[model samples]
Target: MNVLVLMLTVLNCLSKASERTFPRIVPSQLQFLEYTNLTVTCEGFFNDMIQWRVLRKDEKRNRRTSCNKNTDAFGACHIEALYPSDSGEYWCESDDKRRSERVQVTVTVTDVILESPVRPVTVGDHVTLRCIKRKKLKPSTKFDFYKDGVHVNTSSTGEMILHNISLSDQGLYKCNVSEKGFTKENLLQVKAVLLELPDRPVLEGENVTLFCRDKMAASNYTTFFYKDDEMIGNSSSGKLTLNKVFKTDEGVYKCQTSEDRESEEQWLAVRGGNSFSTSDVSGVTHFNMFYLSGLIALPVLLFVLVFIYKKYKGPPVTNEEDEAKYTALTKRDTSLYHELKPPNSTC
Candidate 1:
């Protein structure tokens, strides 16, 4: 009788202490970009007996019988194309009644999609842009490529190729397709490749020259250098020079040919004048130089002002009455000269 009672007690304790060994979905992101293929795997459990469920609103949808295919022994759910309606909490529940933690996923819908390579498009690369419906992959339909909203090319094969890509070919592209008497458009961005660069570890006060070349040789076109999207200089020789580099000169730099070909922005880092390079100072852009310089100077300026005030005003005033008056002056005026005025005097 005692053995039976102890066995029951131990079994109850074990049951109470046991938790779901696998409690999460792999690639556990709550939000996913639309049209992306997502493979959400329920990790930790080694059972093929696991079942996946997606809870949308108040309804429970089965993954095994739905649009997902079981990928492996752990019952990973794979969705080919995710749509907005697919947004919900997903989880895996084992046959033994162990339930994994639910993962919320949201899918967004868009009118068009630009299908391009993941890497930057370079010269000599035959880049192709295919516009497609975000939700479904349907039959090959006629499509047109538009640059800056103007029609450039039309193809019945649903693909437009930029052959022997050059700098002049870079622009904001959009693909348009007519379906069911309605036109759908999507945006595409093509970036130019870096052809040449100066030696690394650019030091302050040193001069450096950079050259930008297009994949194809097009004569009579001038190249313009840009720092943080602002045009710095133009050269017909495809060469741009940085004279007497300052800390302020470091920034994301790019070049565009007169043909309107823009190169990919690259970081130009300038270290202190004493050293050529430092790991901590690398990759910092000069875009915020003005703001950073003001921030650094403000505290030093305040310290100098305080020192001059203490030296000229005789012994330092420390009374509560004087402190209150000082605080009041500071609150009254935002400018340094106004704040430094005597408590009872007006400037």
Candidate 2:
């Protein structure tokens, strides 16, 4: 019974390890215009037991509901014709009560909404913001863009392309259409530097290379890396390669260029070195659960087998004749010892 309990405990741990804590959003953006379609997919090997979760804005309490009759085989929840009421926090949740990180979704009902990524864009990235009108507008309509209420650029295609975004470009942005009013302001964030690393969960003892990239800078700049606010290493190639990383290496990391331009701190999570397949669901895998379960069960099974063998195999049994012979030998040995004893010897 104890062995069975141990095995069960191991299985439970494996199940927890395989759980993914986030869902994937189609189109990869958080904000959308009203009446648009959005698909939230639960990605991972064990996503079959996962479902979509949303907290609508107008609701006084949290509510859980299924997709709008448009679920696919991939565990995706399709929300068609999203209205402003649909704007709220969204995430994925498993039946075991594990939840993914919540993402705030905003659905705007304005006649014009600026099309931009809700997520913060890295520095030196080329981003384009489009002025999307609810009603069909002329292709040649002139559009004006503003950064913090200051006119920056004008475009006839209704799209403003930002070349090599820098820290100075981070501000509130809104666009104006010909004769139409300005769209709602959206914040455009830019980082001075970006540390590029693997998208998957990093396992312990694996070699990881972090690349400090600054697309707008010259190639001759030096890059420095820090872990938990402590300087660890630096390189001229803007790359810091850590060989045989351990769990101790897991921490918040950041990089800076020679010009003191720094990037946003990112956390490095080092998992166990055990071999397991990971899924896109927040860097957790599913198939490795069985493999780890077998590892835990093998030793317990061996121990149980040895215990049973000892329990069934009792001590050696002796017949009556053999017991009498052993007794006679014992008496003879005692008589021989008495005969060999010295006269002066005391008991």
Candidate 3:
């Protein structure tokens, strides 16, 4: 019986001690996006009463608003429509105001006007959008970026980076001032680009080579070869060499290269390895015929020589005596007695 009475007395003392202890609470990192919500709470203090208080660390102003130290032993501190100046250290203290610890409260103030990410960004390019404030604020606070009403990224710094920008990136971008409740918006413009080839190109075969050469001497500029609207080959130096070509190689080929814009294309009308030769056919054909006639005439030339010799030599001219004998027999020596007798004598 005496042991039971002692145990009951000890239990009552322990309960009273538990009720008097108050829980501790602290606020972590704070942010300001034009408007900020700050909540500070106390926990674990069952019996001890908790009171919410706000104090401007720079100006030293104070407030007590936690349940007015009523039924709730733990409490919270809240400030509405927080401003840059409203930012300070706050605390949840015991109702007696004797015990306290600091709760960090942050409020962000954004620049009234922001200038960032100048317009006309090409698709697949990198871009940077910056926000500049009219007035300077505390430097320790970080900045956050948003796109098309969505959170994109944050910088523990004042600048945010966007890489490999795309068409989807085209939207209103705003910067949130994490420390001072400031926000600024800017418009984005993204352009779409296409790959293209040159207009007209003429290629002569064998003795010539075609290139997707640019009128300019730009380096690292590439030329893409196209046939019937589809790309088939790519070159850095722009030259496309065709060696030992065939009829299948004949067709239209175009090349596009890079400049500030695209370079003048070297469009090539590839001839079927022999088209160049065919173009001047009339003259070549005439010369070939002349050469063939000369070659055929070589063997017939000997027969022509033999005919000329037979006509010119032997029996064609007779000496005067034979001529006179024929004349005497046929005409009976009409010229004179001397002509008749002149088988022996020629005059």
| lDDT of candidates 1 onward, in order | 0.58, 0.70, 0.49
Candidate 2: tens digits of C-alpha lDDT, residues 1-347: 44344444434434543323345667666667888899876554222323434322233346654443532222566777888777767765545454555556677876677877655678778999988776665454688999999999998878999998778899989888767678777778787677875655567889999989876678799999998789999999999999999978865678999887887655565667763433332233233465568889999999999999988997656798789999999999999999999999997
TM-scores of the models, in the order given: 0.35, 0.53, 0.25
Displacement of residue 209 (Cα, Å) in model 2 is 3.7
- Best-fitting candidate, scored by lDDT: 2
Q: How high is the lDDT of residue 327 in model 1?
A: 88
lDDT value for model 2: 0.70
Task: Give the candidate order by descending lDDT.
Answer: 2, 1, 3
The residue-by-residue lDDT of candidate 1 on 1-347, one tens digit each, is: 34344444433322332122233443333444576766666432322223543222323443432324433234556777777767666665555444444445556465555554433567666887765564555665687778766788988876888898765666666566675222333323345535354535456889988888865446677888887679888888888888899978865677887666677655564656775133322223232455578889999999999999988989756699798998899876667776587998955
Of the candidates numbered 2 and 3, which has the greater TM-score value? 2
Best by TM-score: 2
Worst lDDT run of 10 residues, candidate 1, spans 13-22
**Candidate 3 regions with alpha-carbon error over 4 angstroms:** 1-112, 194-347
Clashing pairs in 1: 167-261
Report clashes for each candidate as comma-separated counts.
1, 1, 17
The sequence of per-residue lDDT tens digits that candidate 3 reaches over residues 93-117 is 5545533334344455544333453
